[model samples]
Target: MDTMRERFASVTSRLLDEDPRLAVVLADIGVDGFAAAARRHPDRVVNVGIREQLLIGVGGGLALTGLRPIMHTFASFLVERPFEQVKLDFGHQGVGGVLVSAGASYDWPSGGFTHMAPGDVALLDTLDDWTVHVPGHPDEAEALLRHAAAAGDDRVYVRLSVQTNSAPRAVDGARFSRLREGRRGVVVAVGPLLDNVLAATEGMDVTVLYATTVRPFDGAALRAATGLADAADVVLVEPYLAGTSTRFANDALADRPHRVLGLGVGRRELRRYGQLDEHLAAHGLDPRGLRERIAGFLTSAARA
Candidate 1:
């Protein structure tokens, strides 16, 4: 699995092997690779072709019957269509299920506006007790999923970006809580955009905090990590137009004092068509744009 999406398949495939209660469902929009995995694990997998709402409802039902259901669908279809099911069957009733939403952000050129999910994070943030995890790469996805299995949570949304992976460095889930400590500035990154951040500042001294889980954000850790910054320049990277992580980070660390610069799609009413790479790049998401943003953020913070 060269990409994070494939890494998710790897981890979920393992989980499927161990737990009979664990079940994976692929939406019609699922990738061919994951569809193959679902094929291999038929007894433990469910496929609802193009029916995201029914797919989510079935997942909720499966979870209600005391089985773990992992539902994979396009981000827009998963959130927009199944909002009622998510709020009612999933969040309101507190059913256990993992909603894996792929094709976040631009949705590539192949998928038009109907598939592009630029506002899923904002939608999920409004739901009570619902947890959202946007891993920038395979390592973080593995760690986050390990955390999900161990803990008993109401809902979890794992976001997958089409970009390359950038989250394998901190993989051990046991030592996961220590990842957001002893840093001058906390560089909060969401989705695969962290890859751009990692690539932009290769071998730099910046501290990166990858919070796959969005709702119960490690508030204390975020504060501690950023509060002590004598030269605080908290940079948040996300792929969404509204940037869920950046908004959450700002609200979370607001009581504490720190300088913040959020780089993402940045409040554009998205056009009907574009490539993920070009779309992100147009909004300062490429490697070069990321460098300029981080550099300017630090430079401006130094002046302040």
Candidate 2:
């Protein structure tokens, strides 16, 4: 199976052919993939060189002219470097566009900290009305990408990662899918970590919720899952920064007594350039590490 990034290039190339209103803006990151698309729609497919801010600015400009622009780049360059442009160009201007990011957290560790973006989702959370999609499989990524491209004046962010699950779930780009039922607690796995989460929680009596679209979080599903329990013990296992969605979970269960444990990439930088698997294990995101943490959290919660 192709990686999400490769699927993105192919799916987007087809989108450009199908939708004339759709435009793609890049910063020389994935220009090679869109070579044919560029040739076909030179006026619509634009690469603004290495200027990250200009990439967003051009997308915003395109949005103003009644075109839905899809901006692409490394996550760090796309969200962190041009954050001000993202806030002003899209949010402040009240225009809509899709911001698609690759190089999730530590996809290319040799590229160093400059390429990783574990905080992209957390940073975007500070803004209002931005829909965030973290697809775990290439199929899901294609579906979400199509949804975002046609969102029509609504701000959207599609987070593409090198990591993916063994199989794709039926994701509608909204709501959480309840994969298991249990009265003890709920384990919400977000993008690329579902397989590990499943392995970690095997034989455990905990509800497993799969989330691809995190913003506009599926509070209703969370509530329903935990409503039957004596106390809600929620564990959020994300691929990005730890505790990124803790606040959202808290708000979702604000009316009741509940506990939430947020797990993901730690704040401390791992300076050593290692393989992706090593990075995941170091962050306690692998199946073995996750089992220890999740088991401990639930066991302790049971005693409480």
Candidate 3:
């Protein structure tokens, strides 16, 4: 898998190559490296200047006209500023276009907090019948794009950050995690935090479930866990607030010993951080933090 930018560009290239009707409508900031992709695919791509609102409008138009459109821009400009257009034109109509949102959670902070979309989930989750996914790694990003394309679902938003393939595929089904063997507990994981969950419980007998489709989660999986199928300590590590994972988990795993201890970003102003590693550290989701949480649980369990 290539970089996030490259993945977006390359996927668009493939789409253009396969279907001449596919077009990449880029806002001002999203057009640098991907312009060549548009140029090569000529008639398939369009750069629509600085209007984020118009970008969605035009993309919505193309989708309605039976053409596939991939809208590219910062998460902020795409969802935050031009929300009216998104809410009315696309979200309401459930337009079938890919929103390749970059810098989903402060990939680089020098661009300022205004550019950071910590609330990208909340902004989009309000809409009905929308498929929202945040890719923790590049391979998942590529595979998810393919999955969405094939799923035939309109109004899908894929959230991406600059990342390598790290998170393990703990969850299996497109609709839910694999209920293949058993579900011990609601071991919740968001994007990058999955790497921590996998590493933390590597050789242990723990059933961990991960999902970028945090909203309208796998209720079947939760219902399955409600019987005698549960581990003692339920832990959820959300990169954002506990709700995105915790609330959803609690709603599913009612009366379960659910505990959420990840950093809550949108709860308040984000710290002036740039590096992803540093951001994770400040938010109590660094590797060290995760290890401590898991190790503490293991030690306590041993004593029990």
Q: How far is candidate 3 from the true structure (C-alpha RMSD, Å)?
A: 3.6
- In angstroms, the error of model 1 at 153 is 4.7
The number of the candidate with the highest TM-score is: 2
- Tens digit of per-residue lDDT, candidate 3, span 131-179: 7776667767777766555445366777777744454353322455632
* Residue 181 lDDT in candidate 1: 39
Give the per-residue lDDT of model 2 (tens digit) for 212-267.
Answer: 99998999989998986656999999999999999989999999999999999999
Model 2 misses residue 151 by how many Å?
Answer: 0.8
On lDDT, the leading prediction is: 2
**Candidate 1 vs candidate 2, TM-score winner:** 2
In candidate 1, what are the lDDT values of residues 138-160, reduced to their tens digit? 77777777666545644777777
| lDDT of every predicted structure (CA atoms) | 0.70, 0.95, 0.66
* Cα lDDT for residue 172, candidate 3: 29
Q: Candidates' TM-scores? A: 0.82, 0.99, 0.82
Q: Which rank order by lDDT, best down to worst?
A: 2, 1, 3
Which lDDT value does model 1 have at 289?
A: 90
Give the least accurate 10-residue stretch of model 2, judged by summed lDDT.
222-231
